[model samples]
Target: MKGRFWPKARLGDVTCVMGTNGVGKTSLLRAISGTHPRSSGDVTFDGKPLGQMNAHKMAQMGVGYVPQGRDIFPLLTVRENLQTGFSCLPKSEHFIPDEIYQLFPVLKEMQTRRGGDLSGGQQQQLAIARALITKPKLLLLDEPTEGIQPNIIQHIGEVIRLLRDRGDMAIVLVEQYFDFAFDLADRIVVLRRGEVIENAAKQDIAREQLLSIVSV
Candidate 1:
């Protein structure tokens, strides 16, 4: 299926994309990230064609993707895993920023710990911190709340809100957790079968209507 995210103007600071499982939510992110080759259609970021670019190029272009399962290098130390984001940066920008630690203090404490040693919540935080290391303009988060503890989920939500409030980047969150998304999104995009079914500002559509659209 073909799809595009050409918002009339700029996308909101936080845009939540929702659909049931197997509805191509992850596929959309993969396409945008250039991680999966598309059969057709061009993807452009800030007027640059992304269809021909590889994942590394996408990252270098300021697109940070935190895929669903928090893919951290198990054998690598927390610090080492975060540094992997440096692959897209210059030598001078190799060091991790103190801001990343501020956003996730647990990561600062676990800097020397192996990625495999951290709890699921900590691992998720590490994954996000790793992506932030690139200082992306577009951040794509997939099911960030999945399998996470409530307290950790709350903390993650706070971090996301803080990021959005910074007014620097656009966040596209793909989530099934309705309450979580509703609370944070400035707009909502609902999809079904690889196609966008509804795209509207969160206030323009009623919650019941949005729920029904996704259920269809």
Candidate 2:
């Protein structure tokens, strides 16, 4: 994840990371989430320096990561899968919130169903809901729209917007879908060969210019 950097993200804003495949977009997220080791540099959250912490430690510190591929427990029921997020919470906060169901109603209906039984989009929704269970201050989403249907993508986009409008958390979204990312981003960071070629406010860059940069 070297040579990749962006400005500090403020709460209530969406920062979209876009690039061609193999440009370390996912790796960048892994570094932030502490799912992968950070060889160098520092990551600070809420004005505190997070130096070489593990995934669990980061989660405890309010970093919620929904990685690519919707990695849900196949044998676990939808409710069970979400309950896994409780591991990062205190005993008093072990119960799932009604807002989780409110955000994704389909998960409420499939509460008892196994995660593997759900479609790709359903699994994606479950993955996101599970992350929200931690009530994270920083949410990292990697390719949420990948392999998802148009309708679900739109739903997810709306959810992201709602979450942003809530002004409670900061979101870092890694996406390859051009228009989808562009439409939701408050700021844009474009990467190439693990290097950041462009980083600017959404209003500062034209859509066509960004499309040309990533397309190259």
Candidate 3:
């Protein structure tokens, strides 16, 4: 099955992809982000083919990826981790946007702390903040709430909502938490064994039916 995303080039538009485990969810993100090579199919973004573009190239093309594991540079300070995203931007845009701090004030407070020293929730915030540093046009987030505390999960959801409301970048979220995905998604795509089994707008699909589709 194939899933395509064509952003209206506006902010606050969100596409949520949901599925059971091992259903090629992460593979899809890897292919789009150019982190893993795809043997077939085409990925076109903004009317251009993304053929053979490495992760760096994808980043330069305004794609920001926050992988599932919240991968952070353990030894680096939070500020330094954010600075790494500078490679994707021009020298003039090197500074972190004030909005990032506004979205996650904890990051600013822990600017000098090593990434590994932070708790699970704090690390996740840092991962997301680092991605935002690139000021991407398309943001890919994989399971932002996994392993996080309940309060932090709610906070993460709030941040996602805020990002969407700003309406500058399109967000593609991969989440297994059905309720969370349902709340933020303008549209939902469900997959099974790498096949798209369900695709519809949130209001168009009934809640129970959508749950059954993904469960299958």
- Tens-place lDDT digits, model 1, residues 113-180: 99999999999999999999999989999999999999999999999999998888889999999999
- Cα lDDT tens digits for candidate 3, 1-216: 455432332356788889999999899899889999999878778878778789999999999999999899999999999999999899999998888888899999999999999999999999999999988889999999898999989999999888898888889999999999999899888887887777777899999999988887
Please give the RMSD to the true structure for each candidate, in Å: 1.7, 1.0, 1.9
lDDT of each: 0.89, 0.95, 0.88
* Tens-place lDDT digits, model 2, residues 1-216: 445466887899999999999998999899999999988878999999989999999999999999999899999999999999999999999999999999999999999999999999999999999999999999999999999999999999999999999999999999999999999999999989988899999999999999999998
Which parts of model 1 have CA positions greater than 4 angstroms off? 1-12
Question: By lDDT, is 2 or 3 better?
Answer: 2
Error of 3 at 45 (Å): 1.0
- Among residues 3 or more apart in sequence or in different chains, the pairs in candidate 3 whose N, CA or C atoms overlap within 3 Å are 11-167, 11-168, 12-164, 12-167
lDDT of 1 at 64: 95
Q: What does the lDDT come to for candidate 2?
A: 0.95
Q: Clashing residue pairs, candidate 1?
A: none
List candidate 2 stretches off by more than 4 Å: 1-5
